[model samples]
Target: MNNQRRTVLKSGSGAALLGMLAAAGIITPGMALADWNKAAFDAKSMADTLKALGAGSPADSKDVQVTGPDIAENGAVVPVGVASSLPNISMVAILIEKNPNALAATFVLPEGTEANVQTRVKMGQTSNIYALVKSDGKFFMATKEIKVTLGGCGG
Candidate 1:
């Protein structure tokens, strides 16, 4: 009787452990989709890209600030910064006008956290860089033109 009780308890504990692991995403049998759309990135213009990415029409928001050099010596890596003063910032996406794929990067911001992000992106040539901000269920944006002296995409 004692042996049977111990075996049952051990089996129950093992099942519980497996449940916890699955909840924590330690195991997944199939591929995972993370909201990536190739068609959207292939957009020809910034406006088209924004629409395809579901960003809607982003308004010019003074509360959002973008920092970057006015000119870049190398187009391969252009540093960009975005900081939002507004509340409930949900996301930040970087876009380059001249790149084959305009959407460079996208970041999801958690609640009650500071909305600031920085990253380097490749540029095909001298083009406009835009920072798209999502706050309060709306999209806001800021843009700057970065002149690239040396072609990074291909000379």
Candidate 2:
């Protein structure tokens, strides 16, 4: 029993030391973090956001879908989702037409990842939510209107 206890402590201490080294930056992480797109998120208009994201004049597509309640009971926590059935989707972004910043969220999909995402966003009022999808170096988009009973972005 004493020998087993010593073995457990030895392995646990080694793991803890390695974790400390990583946390202290003595060891580098294997994965690199993606840089934030400040310009895209700070854009006040849909067009500007698209421009910042390098997607120009996206065509309307039935293959892209934006799902949300027609009327959001609470503006602060409106549920939304974006999905694309199109092949080779590389990115998906959500835009709120009425928000102070039109660009709400953007997601970059890795290879083999499904082109679908769900999230909650705040709405200032009744507005059209746009889902922009990028596939095979081309951009496509769809929009859905959501009415907010109470203002979330400050009435």
Tens-digit lDDT track of model 2 for 1-155: 24433443487686677567558654434422224676688799989999999999899999999999999989999999998899999999999988999998888999989998999999999999999999999999999999999989784
Per-candidate Cα RMSD to the true structure, in Å, reads 9.2, 9.1
Worst 10 residues of 1 by lDDT: 26-35
Q: Count the clashes in each prediction.
A: 0, 0
- In model 1, which regions exceed 4 Å deviation? 1-34
Give the TM-score of each candidate. 0.75, 0.77
Residues 71-124, model 1: lDDT tens digits: 999888889999989889998889998888788888888886689988988888
Each model's lDDT comes to: 0.81, 0.87
TM-score of 2: 0.77
Q: Which candidate number maximizes lDDT?
A: 2
> lDDT (0-100) at residue 108 of candidate 2?
90
Error of 1 at 53 (Å): 1.9
